[model samples]
Target chain A: MVEYKDGADFLSPDPIETQVLQGSQDSEGVELMVKKNNDRLTGWVSYTLSRSMVLINGLYEEQKVNGGVPYPSNFDRPHSFNLVANYRISRRLSFSSNIVYSTGRPVTLPVAAYYAEGRPFLLYSARNAYRIPDYFRIDLSVNLEGNLKFKKVAHSFWMLNVYNLTGRSNAYSVFYEVEDGAINGYQLSVFARPIITLSWNFKFGNYNSN
Target chain B: MNIQHTYKYTVTKLFPGGVRPKMHLWVVLIIALAVNSCIEPYFADIGDEPELISIEGSIIKGLSRQEIVISRTTSLGNPVFEPVKGCLVSVMDELNNEFVFDETYNGIYTLEIDQSSLVEGRNYKMVVVTPGGAHYESEYEILESSVPVDSVYYDIEPSLDPVNGIEADGLQFYVDLLAPDTVSRYFRWKITETYEYTSAGPIHYYYMDLSFEPVVPDDIWGLYRCWKTDELEDIFLTSTLNLATNEKKQIPLNYVSTLNDRLKIRYSLLVHQYALDEEAYNYFMQNKIATEGSGGLYTRQPQQPITNIYNVDDASERVLGYFWTSEMTSRRIFVSKLPELDVKDYFYPLEIFNMEDHGAGPFPMAIMEEDGVRITGSPICFDCTRRGGTTERPDFWE
Candidate 1:
C-alpha cells in the first residue's frame, strides 16, 4: 500500500470517451368511448392511455439525442380524457358543455448555466428530459331556438358561447431568454384566457343551420 | 324540439327573411387582439442535474502574467460561480521548462513568465491537482504566433437591430488582418471599451434639517467627468479556413447604438486578437451558437460542449472549458466628435416595478431637470457611473 502525508500524485489524462446510440421507437396506446343518445340529449365521453419511446445510436452516432436510451417522444401524452354533454330545459332551450384533460407534452430545457467571460450561458438537458405542465380546460354554450314554423319565411336561433370556461393557461410551448447575465424561462400560450361570443343564426329554404 | 343547423331542402321555405345584426367596430378590434399569443415565466423541473467542473485558461505569449480560472457550474435559475480553490497548478512545455502558478485569488492562478520565455512551435500542457487530490490535465496544445492587427477602425451606419427591429444610426467597429497566406485561418478577438461621461445633471434643490420648503444650494452634486471601461462580453469569431487567402478586410467586431453612452464624448477601444487551433476554434464556434440564444422557433437543440481538460482517471468525468496556447496581439484607438453620426444615451428605469425590474426601490433619488422639472432615479442614473461603471477616469483616456 502507498501512502502520502498530503495527497497521492496521478498522471496522464484519459482518452476522450464516446457513446454509441442505436435503436428504434416503440409506442402503445388504448382508447375508450361511451356515448349517450336520446330525444333530450346526445353526447359522448372518451379516454385514452398511451406511451411513446425511442432509442437510436446511429444518427451517424452523433449522440445528439437521448444518449441512445429509450425516451418519450416530443408529442407524447400518456393520459387524456374528453367529455361533452347537452341538457334540454325546454323544447327550444338547450345548454352544452365540454371538459378535457391531458398529460403535458415532452420538452427539453436548460438545466444549468455555463459561465464564460463573467457571463452565464445556458446548458441544456437531454432531449425530452421533462414535460410541460398538464393541460385542462372547460367550455360551455347555450342555444335558444325561435318559434318552429315551416310556413314562416325562415327559422332563427340565438347562441351564446363561452370558450375556456375556467380560463386555463395551457402551454403551447416553452422558451428561454438571457438578460443582464441571468437566464429566465417562459411559456407561451396561444389562448391564455376565456372568450365569449354571441351570434344570431338564420336558416333559409336552401340552407338552415345554427 | 331543438333546432338543428341544416342545409335548405331542395324546395322548402326557411327563415324567409334572413336575420342581419349590426356588429360593433370595437368588438372586431378586441377579437383581433385576442388572437395574439401570450407568454408567462416558467420554471422547469429537470430531475437531478450534475454539478460540473469548469476550467478555463490560456497562455498568452506576449503578456507577463498568464492566468487560469477554475469554477463550478450551477443551476440556470441560480447560477452562482462557485470557485474551486487551493489547487496545485503547473505548466510544462516541450523543452522541459516547468513553471508553477501561484494562487492569486480563490480560484484564479497566475504565473509571471517573461514574454521571451514563451517559445513558438513548442507544445504546452497544463496539469491541476485539486485540494482533494483529484488529478486533471489538458492535452498538449501547440503554441503558434498570432498575426498582428493592421488597424482598428469604426464606421457609422444604420443597423437593423434584430431584437427591437429598429434601424438606428450607430457606430460599427472592425479589425483588419494582414497575415500572409501561409498562416492559420482560425482566430478569435475580444474588445475592451472605455468611455467618458457626465452625470445626467444635478438636483437644484435638497431638503434641509428644518425647512418648510426645499432649499437651493450654491454648489450641487455633479460628477462632471468620470470614465468607465467595460470588456465587451460578446464572442467575436472569424474563420477563413475555406478561403484560399489568409488576409481579410473589414472583419466586423462590435456595434453600439448611438442611443447609449459608449460614444457620448470620447471613446476608446482596446482590441486583442488571438490565433487558435482547429479544436479550440470549433469549440468556440459551437459555444457561440449556444450563447447567442436565439430561443426562436428555429433554435437548434444544444449539446454539452466537449472540454479540452479531462480527468486523469476517468474519461466520463464532467469537465467544462478549453485550455489552449495562443500568441496574442492588441491595438487601441480613441475616437471623439465624429460628424457623420449622432449619439444618444439609452434610457433606463431606476425604480423596480414588476418583471425583469431590479430597481433602486419603491423610492429613488429625485433630481431636478435643467428646466427645474423633477425626475426620480438612483444615484447611478444621475452619475457618470450610472447603470454600471467606474467613477475614476482611466489614465489612458485623453
Candidate 2:
C-alpha cells in the first residue's frame, strides 16, 4: 500500500531552526522507514544517494559583484544511511545499537581574494563549490529492570556507550587567514567524543494483575 | 524414432543461441538510456561569478520625478542590483527635446519641468545610457489635475484658550474634500514674512512656499527652528488638505514682540494632479521639502543639482494658484492710547494682532524657561530670547 504522510512539522519553514532544508531534488536524498513485529529487533535504514543544489542569484561568470550572490545556500550530499536495532536478550535486559553514514556536505570556497570595507565577507565561487569528507558513527546502549521479592520493590539500570565503534572527524567549515602571504586551508571539524555512562534507579509500585 | 539425431542438433542451438541474443539486447538498451541522460541526481559544481550589467533610469512627468533602479539576472537566473556610476539618464519628448540626467549624487538624477511643459496630453519617456554604452528606455503619459483648493483664510478672532496664552491662533486652508481623497492631487504652498529685528531698523524678511500640498508643517517649521535657535518652531499651524472641501481655513503667523520687533507673514499654495504610487509620491514629497530647507536650490541646467525636479516648471503653468498675506506693526492701538487714540499698536503694541483679542488664548503656546536673562519690569527683556534669536548682539539688532 502506498500512502502520503505529513510529518509533524511538514509545513513548517525551519523545523529544527537550523536554517537548512531537510531535502530537495537537486540537493539531498530523504528517507522513510517501516516497522515490523515489535520493538525487539526494530531497526531503521536510510540512505541519501542523491544530491541537492541552489541556483544562486549572482554566482556566475556574468554576475560577479564585490558582495557575492544572494546566498545560494548550498545543501548537497549523496549516499546517506542510518541503521538502528534493538534486541531483548531476556525478560529483564535489552540492548540497542545504531549506525549512521552520510556523504560529505557541500561548501563554498573563495578562489582569488580581495579586501572590501575592511571586513572579511566572501565573494564565493560558484554554487556547491566544495565537499567535506564523509561521516560515520555507531552507538550502543543496554537497560535492565526487575521486581524484587515480598517487599514490593523494583530496580532498573541503564548503560550507554557513545561512539561504540569507529572514531572519526566530520568537517564543517574551511577558510584561510591571510598572515604574510601564504594561503592555507584552516580546517574545522566535529571530533568524536567517545563516552559511556551508567545509571541505576529503584521504584516502589503495586504489581496488580487484572 | 528416426528423428532422434536431428532433434539433438536443434535442441543444442535453441538452448544457447536464442536466450543469449535476447539477454545481450536488453543490456545494451539499458546502457544507452543511462549514457544519454543529463539529469544527474548529483548537483553540479558551480564556478565563480562575473560582473553584472547595471540599468539606471527615472520617472519624470510634470512636477513628479522618481529614481528607477534595476539589475541584471545571474546564471542562476536571479536579478542583482549593481553599484552603478557615470550614466546619462534622461527623459525626452517626441520633439527631440531632452534633459541630460546629472548624477547629482549616487544613483539619484534630476529633471525639472514647469506646469507649461506638462501638457494635458503629451507623452514622456525616460532613456538611460549606461556606463558600458547600453541604452534602456520606458515611457509614460502626462496627467493634468484640477484646482484642489476653493479658498484659504485666517480666523478673524484671537484664541480664547488661555493654555496657549495671549497669541494669534493662526490661518487654516480648507479643501473641497478629505485629505488623500481616492483621487490624488499634488499641491504646494508658500509663506512670506518680514519681522523687524531691533528698533524698527532691520526688517528680517522670510519667504517659503510648498512645492506641492498638503504641506508637511513640521518640515516647514523646521527651517524656522534652524534660523532662530532659541524657540521651537510651531509646525502644527501649517496644514495640507488632500481632498476637496468648501470650508474656509486659516494660516496663523503668531507675532513675536521684541526689542528688535516688527512682524509680517505671507504664504501661497500650489496643487497638481498626477498618478503616483504611494512610495514614489512620498519620496518625491519628502525629498522636495527636506531638500529645500536643508540646502541646494533645484534650477534648470544640466550641471550639478540638488534634486531632479529643478527647472521642470514653465511659464503659463496652470497650477493651483498662490496666496499672499501681510502684517505691518504700524497699524495697531494699545491700552495706553485707549482715551486719546486707543489705537491697537499704540499702547500695548504687542496685544493688537494677538490671538486673545480674537479669544484664542491661554495661548496654546509652549512653556519656555528663563536663561537667567532677567525681566525686571514692564519691558519683559531677556539678555537672550528663548527662541535663540537674541537682542544682546549688535548684529541681532540689525
Candidate 3:
C-alpha cells in the first residue's frame, strides 16, 4: 500500500512562496549484471531501468505542484548503464576502460510571458517541468607494473587514466534569455573535453598482484 | 534465500547475485573538466505555458472615471497581449451600492462613479464574472483617509550603485509626506509625466489642398505646440509602520537620467499617492520586487503571491491580480529648465521640398524654420500632432 506525503510547492513565478501541499512518491527499478572473470580478463557490465515519481496537489485548494501532477524528482534518472573492462596483456601491463550513460536531472522553465501595466512578467509551468540533456562519457586507463621481485621489500605501479575519451559536451543546465525579440536558450556544462591523469602508486608488502 | 549465510556479509546483500565491485573499477573513475560547446544560442524549444488572466485596477475617492485592464498572456518571449473580452465586472460597497463597469475597449473596462458615493471609511470589493461563468471576488478593503503630500520635488545628484561601483550624475525625484496619524501610514506612488513639444515651425508648404494656399499663420497653425502624457510603470512604495515617529521625508520616487527627452522642455510629474494598510502594502511590495527583476521570475523559481482575491465557487482557480480600493491624493510639479544639466540634442531629419519637385500646379508654399534652419518635408516635421500628441493643452498645465 502506497501512502501519501507532504511537501512544499511553488507554482507561480515570483517570490517563490512555498505552499504546503500533499503528494506521494513511488519508485520501481530493474537491474542486470554480467561479470566475466578469467586468467586473462576481468570485466563487468551493469544496466539499470528505474522510475521515480512524485505527485503533489493540495487536497483543499488543488494546488498543482511539486510538479502540477506526477513528476520526476531531481535525481530521477530512468535509464543508467555502466560498462567496465580490464584486459591483462602481459605480466607487467594491463588495460582498463569504462562507458557510463544516464539521463539528466529535471529542471524548471518558464514557457510563456506577459506584460501588465507596461511591466513584463513571465509564466512558469509546474515545478521541475523539463529536463536537461542526457549524459554520456567513456574513459580509459592503463596500468604498468614494476619488475616483479618477491624478495624486495616494496613494489610499485604506474596508473594512467584518460577521462571522457569521446569528448561529449554534456549539459549541466539550460537557461533562457530574450535577445533580438526572441527567446534564446544556452546549455551550460562543467566538462566538455577529455582529461588525463597519471599516478605512481607503491605498496610495502608487494601486494600489487592482479 | 539463504538469509543466514549472506547476513555475515551484510554489504553484499543489496545485489541479487551478491556481486561486489572490484578495486580496478574504482581506479577507472576519473572525470570533469572545463566544458566547451561550439553550439550557438537557440530559441528554446519546449511545451506551452498555460494561459492565465491578468487584471489591475483601482478606485479613487474623488475621481469620477475608473478603468480596469483585463488581458491574457501570450507565448514565450512575446509580451504582446491578447484582451479577454465579454466579462462582467463591478465593484460593490458595504452599503450595497454597486457600480457596474462596461467594456469600452478591448479588455478595458470603465465606470463613471458618482464621487459622493466613494465615501471614506467604506468597505469596497470587486466581483468579476468571466465568460465561462466563473465568479471571483476580492476581499473587502476599507477606504482609508489619504495622507496629504507635503512636498514633491527633484534634485540633481549622482546615480550611485555601490554594489556595482557605478557613479553618474542624474535627476532623482523624491516626495515628502505629512506627519502620520495614530494608525499606520503606508504609501505608494504612481508617476504620470506630461510634456509639451513643438514642430519645426508652422506649415512649411501646403501642396495637398489647392484652396487658400497657406491660410493659417506660422505661429497659429495649431501644430506649433502639443502635449503628450504617459504613466510610468516603476512601482515605488514607502511606509512608517515600523518607525519610532512614523514620519516620511525625502522618500525616493523615480530617477530620471539626463539622456532621455522627459525633462527637455516643460514637463509635469503628477504623483498619484495611495494610502494603504500594512497588508496591502506588503502585497504591492512583492510585485515591486518581481516586476523590477530581470525577466520577472523567468530566470528564477516560481512563487505564488498571497493575494486577497479568490474564486467564489472553486478555491483552486487562481486569478492573478489585486482589486484595490483607497483614497488617492495627487500632487503635480512642473519642470521647465535644467540649466545645470547638458541634454542630448534632438535629431530631426528634415528635407527640402517644392511643388516643382513633384507636380508644379500648387498655388502657394510656406517654409518652416527651427533655430533659423528652414526646411519643408513631411507633415511630421511641420506638425507636432503627427506624432502621438494633442493640440489641446491639458487644463492642469501651468
Candidate 4:
C-alpha cells in the first residue's frame, strides 16, 4: 500500500527553533527471508535493501537546508541482515542466538573551511553525504527448565542471556563541533560494551492448560 | 486435575515479597537504555572548491572615472583577498566604440569616458582578458532613462539594537522618486554620507623646550573641526511595477542610531538613483535575498549568485559578479540635531587638564572650562587630520 506522510522534523545545528525544517520522505525496500522451523536447528535468516530520502524546500533563503537538494534520510540504511536460531540441547535445556548487521546511517559533516571577517567558518558537505560505520552485533541466551513432564502442577525455568557478545563499538551518530576556533569530528556509540543478565520465570497449569 | 487449583497454588508461592520492586528496576534499566544516544565529531574531505574570476562595475551617465574591480576567489581557509592584476579591461558599445581602462590600483581599473558617449538607450558590455589568457565578457546591458529624485529626507523613528535589546531613537533616511508618466522602472540607490565630528578635546598648548611649561600657539588652525565620508555597503532596491502610479514615495535607504556620533553636529547624505533593467533587477534581488537572508528553519536555500558574465571559451567555467549600465540622478540633504532633545545625557564632555595645577607658573594654555577648572585637551581634538578627512569643505556642501 502507498502512504503519504508530512511534517517530519529536520533538525539543524545552526539554531534550534528556527532551524527546524519540514520535509517528507519516501522509502522503498525489498525484504527476503528463509526459515527452517521443524529441524533440530530451527532458525530464520532475513535481509532487506532499502533507500530513503527527503526534500525540504525551506520557506526562507536562510532556512533552506542543503541547498534545497534531496538528502538521504537520517534513518536510511540500504542493507540489513538478521539471523535468529534456536537449538534444543536436551528436554530441559535449550540455546538461542541472534546476529544482526546493517549499513550505517547518513550524517552531515564539515568538509572545508574558509575565513570571513577574521573568523574561521566551516563549509559543510551536502546533508547526509557521509555515513557512520556499519553496525553488527550478536546475542546469545540459554534457557533451563526445572521439569518437562507432560503433566505437572507447577513449572519453573531460568534464563541466562548475553547481549552484544562480541562487544562491538558501533557508532550511533557522528557530529562536528567547533572548539578553539577549529572544527572537529567525533563518534558516539550507544551500547559499546557487552551486557549479561539472569532471570527466572515460573508457570502453573494443569495438563489441559499446557 | 483442576487447572484453577494448580494456578492458585503456584501464584501464592511465586511472589514471596512482591513484583513491584523488580518491576521498578526493570523500568529503570529500560529508561537508561533509551537515553543512551550519543554524538561524536565527524570529518570528511570534500576536495577543493574551484576559484573563479570576479568582476564588479557599473556605468552611469554623466559620471567620470568609471572603474571596475577584478579579483579571484581564494581557496576556502584563506582570508586574504587576491586581486587579479595586469589584465586588459575595456567597455564597448553596440556602435563598436570602446573606452579603454587603465589599472590605476591593484585589481582596480579606471577610465574617463566622455559624457556624450553614454547615451540614454545605448547598449554596452565589458570585456576582460586575464593574464592567464582567459577571455571573459558580459552580456550587453541597455542603459535605461532614470527619474530624478524628488527629495531626500529623514524621519525620527524608534529602532531596536540587534545586539542589545534596547529601544533607541534613530534616523531613517528615505528617497522619493518623481512619478513617471506610464512606464514602470526599477530603481537602485547608492548613498554617500558625510558627517562632522571633533576629537575628545583640543590641545591648544604644548610643553616647550622640555621646561614643563606650556606655550600657547600663535594661531589656531583646522585641528578642531573634522569631516568623514562613508559609502553605504548594503544593497538598496525598489520598483514601481506594481504600484498604482509610476512613483515610489519615501523608500528607506538607511538608518543611523541617535547614539551614533554622526548625528552629533551635522550630517549630510547624497543618494544616487539608478534606473535598472529587469534582468539586472532580478540579479540584484537574488543577491539581496542570498546575502541578507538569515539561515535557520525558515531560511531560503543558499545558492551561488548567477552572473551575466561568462568565459568566452569555456561556458561551464564559473565567473563571479555582475556588469550593467544605467542612467542615474542624485539628491543631497543635510540633517542637524533637533533642538529640545536632551543632548547632555548622550554627549560626554572631553577631558581637559590644567597646567596651573602642575605648578607651571603663568603658562598660557588654551582654556575651555567648566566649574572654573582650566582645561587643556588632547592632540586628537586639536588635529582634524587624525580623523581621516579634510578640513576643506566639500564643493557641493550647502
Q: In candidate 2, what are the lDDT values of residues A56-147, reduced to their tens digit?
A: 22443222211233322334556778888888887567788888887767654443322211111123343444665567778877877554
The TM-score, computed over Cα atoms with residue i paired to residue i, of candidate 1 is 0.62
What does DockQ give for each predicted structure?
A: 0.20, 0.01, 0.21, 0.17
Strongest candidate by TM-score: 3
Candidate 1 CAPRI-style tier = incorrect
Q: In model 2, which regions exceed 4 Å deviation?
A: A1-32, A36-41, A45-84, A87-93, A97-141, A146-155, A159-210, B1-83, B94-97, B112-115, B139-146, B149-274, B277-398
Which candidate has the highest lDDT of all? 1
TM-score of 2: 0.33
CA-lDDT, candidates in order:
0.74, 0.37, 0.72, 0.71
Best-first order by DockQ: 3, 1, 4, 2
Candidate 1 chain B weakest lDDT stretch, 10 residues: B2-11
Over 4 Å off in model 3, which ranges? Answer: A1-83, A87-97, A101-103, A125-130, A138-169, A189-210, B1-48, B159-170, B204-221, B294-302, B350-366, B369-374, B377-380
At residue B212, what lDDT does model 3 achieve? Answer: 29
Against the true structure, what is model 2's DockQ? 0.01
What's the best-to-worst order under TM-score? 3, 4, 1, 2
Give the winner by DockQ: 3
